[model samples]
Structures are given as C-alpha cells and as structure tokens.
Target: MASCKFLFIYPDINEFSHAYDGNNGCYYYGIAQLSSVLKRVGVETGLLHYTLRPAKEKFLNDIDNFTPDIIGFSSTTMMIADVYEWVRWIRESGRHSPLVLGGSHATLDYKRVAADGLFDVIFIGESEESIVEYCQHYRERPTNILGTVVKGDNDYIFNPARVLEQNLDRYPFPDWTLFDYESLYDMKTHKRGILMAARGCPYRCSFCSNDRYADLYRNKGKILRIKTVDYVIREAKAMKIQYPAINYFQFVEDTVGFDRIWLKEFSERWPREVGMDFYANLNVNVCNDDTIKLLALAGCRRLQIGVETGNESRRKEILKKPVLNKTIEAVVKECHKHDIDVNSLNMIGLPFESEENILETIHFNARLKPKLLQCTIFYPFPHTSLYDYCVEHKLISESNLSRTDYFRESILENPKISQEALYFFRDNFKTLIKIYRYVNIDWLIRLVGYKRAGKIIRLFRTRSELKKWLYQPRKKLLKYV
Candidate 1:
C-alpha cells in the first residue's frame, strides 16, 4: 500500500468557550502513543487538537487540507457532544474517509458508540497491536481484530477484547512532536514537563473507569504495570535535555508510588541524575511515612492526594475509597513534616450529599491544612458504578444528561442537595476555608441553618453584580470574627 495520511482529532475539551488553538497545555498519552506506533509502521500522521467548537468553514478546511484516509477521534464521555458535532461536519462536507472513534468514552461505552452509526469502526481497550493491524489493512474491510467494534452485515461486530500490554516500555515514548510541545511547555506558568511513568491503578474508585478497565482485561495480566526505574529515569533525562527550560516534572500517572520497590529505586536515582523538582499524584492509601520521606529525598516538592470526601462512612461505602480519616490526617501530617506541599483534591455535590456534607469536606480540608485545595462537582461518566447508581436511583437519566465539565456543575437531579448550595460551596470553597481558619463557620451555619444559608448564597448567582458587592463585606466581617 502507498503511504497513507492518518489525521487524528483530539477533542481536548476544557472550557467550551475557549478557542480551537493547539496550545492547550495538555498531552494525551493515547493519541501521542498511537501516533508514534503508526509512524513506526511508516504511516504519515497529523493531529487536530480542538478545544473549542469549530465553525463549519474552518472545520471543513482542516479536513480538506489533511485529506486523510482515516479520521480518528479521541473522546471522553464529557466530550462526546463535541465529537458528534465534528463528525456531522465531516459527513456534511462529503468527506468519505472512514471515521474511527477511540479513547475512554469509546472503551467504556463501545456498545453505545457502535450503535450511534457515527463511526465506521470503534476501538475499545488498549489498541496498540490491533491498531497497527487495522492501519496496515485499512483499504480492505477488516474484522475479527481484537479490541474493536466494527460494522458488519446485518449488525455490528463485537470483536474479542485485546490483552492489556504487560511491558509498557516496549511501546515507543509518546510522539510529543505531533503536538505543539514547546508551546504547551511555554504556556505553563512554571514550565512543567508532564510525563507518565506507569499504566493502570489497582483501586476501584466508584467514579473512576479504572475498575471497569481492570474488569475488561480481567485475566489478561497484572492490572497495574510500572515502567522499569531505568526506563523512567531515561525518559526524564530525555525530556529535560530536549526541553532545557523545564522547571519541574509532573508525573501525570494515576499514582507513581504504586510500586514501593520501583519508587525506592526511583527515589534514589532521580535526585542524583535528573535533579529537578517534581510533583506526583499518590493514592492517599500509599502516602505512608516512608513513601513521604522517599519522595522528599527525590526532590518532590509537592504531591496531590485525593480525599474525595471527608465523611469516612460515605467514602468507604459510597465512593469505595476505604481510606480512614485517621490515615488521611496522618498522610497530610507526614507530608508537612517532610516539607512537601500537600494538595488535597475533594469533590462536592455527590448524590445524597447535603450542604452540611460539603461543609464537612471543606472543614476537613481546613484541618488537613493542605497547601492547595481543589474541589469539583461530581460528574457521573457512563458505566462507572456511581453513574449506574445515579441512573438507577433516578438522580440522572443515563441517556439524557447533557455534557458537563465536572468543575462547572453536576448533572444529577439530587433531591437532598440543591445545585445552588453546590455552586455556593464550589465558588466560595477557598473563602470558606479562609473563614474557617479565623472563626467557626459552623456558628453561622447553626444560626441560619443549611437551607437558609444556601438561600442567602443563591444571591451570588441570581444577582451577579450584587455578588461582588456582598462578598467583600461578608469576608471582612468574617475577618473581624
């Protein structure tokens, strides 16, 4: 076959209103890795990183310019609406390239994606090997390929699932050159070198897709796979050398400290070789005292630990994160002792969670005294356990909910909690944290009650201009308290 042009569209949806520029400071591992694998097999690759909804003219112009044989889209559940819009444009423009859908949304909701009739083919789980075979025989109708859903006579074909790759290092380092890597680095405030040193998270957080993914490839191999310590150190060195201006490294894996032996070896070698300040995500359960010390010794200046909710019962039963409150407290305390800045991640507006529950999370953060705190409204993605719960309990319609950015608002129609209260806590979470530091916010909650407080805070949304006018004095009064 002659050389083929493969154009991949990454609907990197952040805020809907942002422009369709390529400078979105994100590197999707799936896209880059796929691109590299395709390139290795001598296929030409190009990318359209769209952050905004595209105008018809510009969207068609990009498609016409690239003139690809295969038009692949990488999508998440939240970004499916954007993908639908783009695919419609491609069809209306009379482009006959075979459309392929892949990524988290495709893997989790392959049946839905296949039934949509939007794409000619759908790739489900890890498709490195299957993708290469598909690319090699794109001109002919291919079937029975592992880890794909394809259209067939009479009905769609559900192919056998692919085994998860055991040795992650066998795959080429992601082709960052496909993306505007320099602009992504330059756009950042602190010039972070984003890298992923591992694949898979063993924990089955209810809201996360890891559990479902693990179940998909149940007997394939070990669920959690980490790169060799030497491989990671080499990749770090390569990134640092290529981008000399990188101030720090952020390992964007689920949890870099999953393997104690790998972490121990990494901790010893990283500071001596790469010698750059780094940050990583660690599961709260893994943030033991020895791990904290090792991380600090490796020049880790900060770590992000997900506390999800402060209510231990809810965390254990509802969220399926069995970490105790005592463990969380000890983790934060140990991080501080090692002079590592702790960034605590929390969520609000969960199903059946009340204003008091949100306040409990906020007060929990105050007690932990994390250097940074981030809270987002819970978004129930398709096929996750919580999503099924939301659907079955009538909190949200599984098929009818609109696309949502979790940071913006929840799609759940929960009776126990109002969106107003959720918006209030989300908008003023930091302010409430500050106020809690000075005085007891619970006193005001007690005086007015949760419902009344929620009603009062709704003014910030109802009268947008009055929000600023009222916010300053409220904070000032709290300062006096």
Candidate 2:
C-alpha cells in the first residue's frame, strides 16, 4: 500500500465521547478545514476517526489499516491527560509515525509538549498553511521546517502564526460532507455543524481557558482575523455547493456581534447572498434595541448570552462585566421583544461567588425566562484571568499535562465556603433551570444518547428536594483550583 503524505487522527478518550450533557469529545472545524486545504493542495490525507464509544475491534482495525507518513492529533486543556495517554501509546507502539499535536492544548503548552519529546512536532496556531509547507519538504530536509519544534538543543522556537489567510476566498470550503456532524450537539447547537468565522477572544474572563485556543496570536493582543462579509457569503455559498445538506451554520465566534458594523453588513447582505440560518454568541453588553433588530433581520434563530451573574457588585468589581444588571435585562427584554430566542450561559463557580451570589443568578434567570438556558460547572480554563487569580490566592494546585478537569476535585480556596457544598450546589445547578422551565425535547433526546438516561432523569427528580439538600452545606476534603 502506498503511504499517504499525512493522516489526521482524533485520539479516542473513553467516557468523554459518550458524554453529551457535557463535553462531546470530538474534534473541531479544524479537521474539516485542514482536510479540505490538504486535498486542494494535492496532499493525500485520511482521517482515522475512533469515536469514544466505537467498538474496540473496529478502533483497532481502523488504525492498523490506514498506515501513513505522519499522524496529527488534536486536544484540549481538560482532555490533555487522556491525550497524553494516546501520545504514549504511539510512542510505545514501536512505530515511527513522526506524531504532531495541534489545537488549543498543544498551542498553550508548547514548552511542555516540546520538552517532553512525546510528539515529533507541535504545529502552532492556525496550522493549516504551515502544515502544507512542512509536508512538501519533510522528505528533503526535515529539520529545517518552519513552525515546527525539533527535539535536541533545548531551543524554544516560536514559529510566527501564519497570518490570517488574506485570500481566504482561495481556500477550499470545509469538507463537512465527508463526516457525520449530526451526532455532535451541545445546549446551544442541537445536532449541528459549525463555521469558524473568527478566533481569539479579547475579553479577559477569569474562568475561561482560552489562552490555548488563541495562544499564537495573543502576543498581538485582542487582535482578530475575521472572514469578510463577502468571504462569509462565499463560504456559505460553498457549503451548499459542497455539502448540499448541512444541519446549521454556526458563527463559532467568541462574540459574533463584536463588530456591529460587520454584522450590520452581514444582516443586510447575507439573507440574499447565502440563504441560511445561523446561531451565534452575543455579548449582552454589546447588544441593544438596534442590535436585536439587526440580528433578527439577519435570520438569527438562536442567541446565546453569557450572563455570568446578577450580583451588580460582582458584575463590576469581581467579574468585570462591562454592563450592569439593568443593561442585561434591557438586552434580554429587547431580544424577547424582537421574538428572538435566548439562551443564558450561566456559570456555577467563581472567585468571589457565594451562596447569596448563586441566588442572585437563580432569581435573575427566573425573571428573564429565556427560551433555553445552558448551565455549566465552572471549569477553570488555563491562561485566563481566573487562572491567574487562582494561582495568586493559592487556589490552584500545581497543574500540568495530566490535569484534565480544571478542579482536580471539588474545591473552595477561601475560608468562607466548603468545597463539598460547592460541588453539591454545582451538581444541582441544572435542576434550578428545570424548576423554571421544562428541558427542550431535542436537548433531552441528545442527553439520553449519552447512555446515562437514569442519571439525567434522577437529576430533575424533585427540584425542591435538591434545593433543600443544596441549602444544607457539607464539607469534605476536595482539591479544586
């Protein structure tokens, strides 16, 4: 069999793949984008996909059958422990595949990944362009490839991130038609596909682990490389041309409405240009009556806003939410007035959050009553404002490639609250949402797909009972940072 120039393999991490209420455990749009680019440039490529729940025999069969020149795997901060296990497998496999690691996890931890010598190369951010150059010349002088780390001299080579492709118009449309996108779902997007228009968020949210995602570019500051309106229309037009049938077109931007003028242009032009409904995130503070009107005209069916908390003091002094509670209410009201569906992106754990702070959250949502709401237990993302605070306050235990969950276990660093109480409260945060409104059937169906049907059902057994239990605090020995 002729060896292919490259192979993209999404390593299998058991338990996480089947989880739908949380991490779907799948690769991002990079796979589709990179695959399309490689194929367009005439590089022979294959995807060795082994989903978390794949039959063991099939997983082994796929790996053994598709032998290629290089293997590239993607990972995240929480999943790096599982990812390291897979990297170890490749190293101990007795085969020299010249493994490479890409995506957020590898980008932030370049020093760690490179120093460990587990991966042959670590492709820095937006690796598509650099990867092509590496493949073309690997057979000649492999050591001279730019944007790659070769293990020997303890050199900290920081390859400049490929400038955001100016001629993005030239890149091949993402090959979503090649993979199964319907199986991937989260609270905001139900059984969907994604379109990445922009990357690197400027907001310094304390809990977010975004540094890894935007690592190569942060040195440049909150600078973003956005696809032009023409490019977005061009991409959307190509989506139908290529995939023919796609579930949904999501902006995948940290804040889609970041640039009001860009969205205004998209809202005015795209309905006629591409003719597709897109779901996107809206920074609550940035939105207003005009913003809602523009977005409604743009065919935005779903809008997700990060309403971290309702505590006004916490919003300003602690969380740094630019707008006040009234600002959020006005925005939510305007969204409702425009007949746009709203989803509250709520957080459970925070640096200065308290039981009273949580009630403010519950009361805030009870009043707003969004069509949908997403509840997340705070996962302290590395390289965020929160991560720094945690380190400074002796909140975070020393972390490394092996720490998957942000909190090593349930935890509270301050003397005010107990770790056990925080965990129990966090565990029942979902029920609080259910107390106000029924879970969407589509969301419930997807959750059931996780194979944890009993757990999902028992979670909402009696909101009152759960609330009473949460009210009574319990302390335990738990490490969380």
Q: What C-alpha lDDT do the candidate models reach, one value each?
A: 0.81, 0.64
| Model 1 C-alpha lDDT versus the unseen true structure | 0.81
Worst 10 residues of 1 by lDDT: 460-469
Model 2 lDDT at residue 84: 70
The residue ranges of model 1 lying beyond 4 angstroms of the native Cα positions read: 15-25, 185-187, 442-481
User: Which residue pairs overlap in candidate 1's backbone?
Assistant: none
List the candidates' TM-scores in order: 0.91, 0.79
Indicate the residue-level lDDT of 427 in model 1: 75
lDDT of 1 by residue, 17-82 (tens): 233244654667778889999999988999998766678899889988988999999888888888
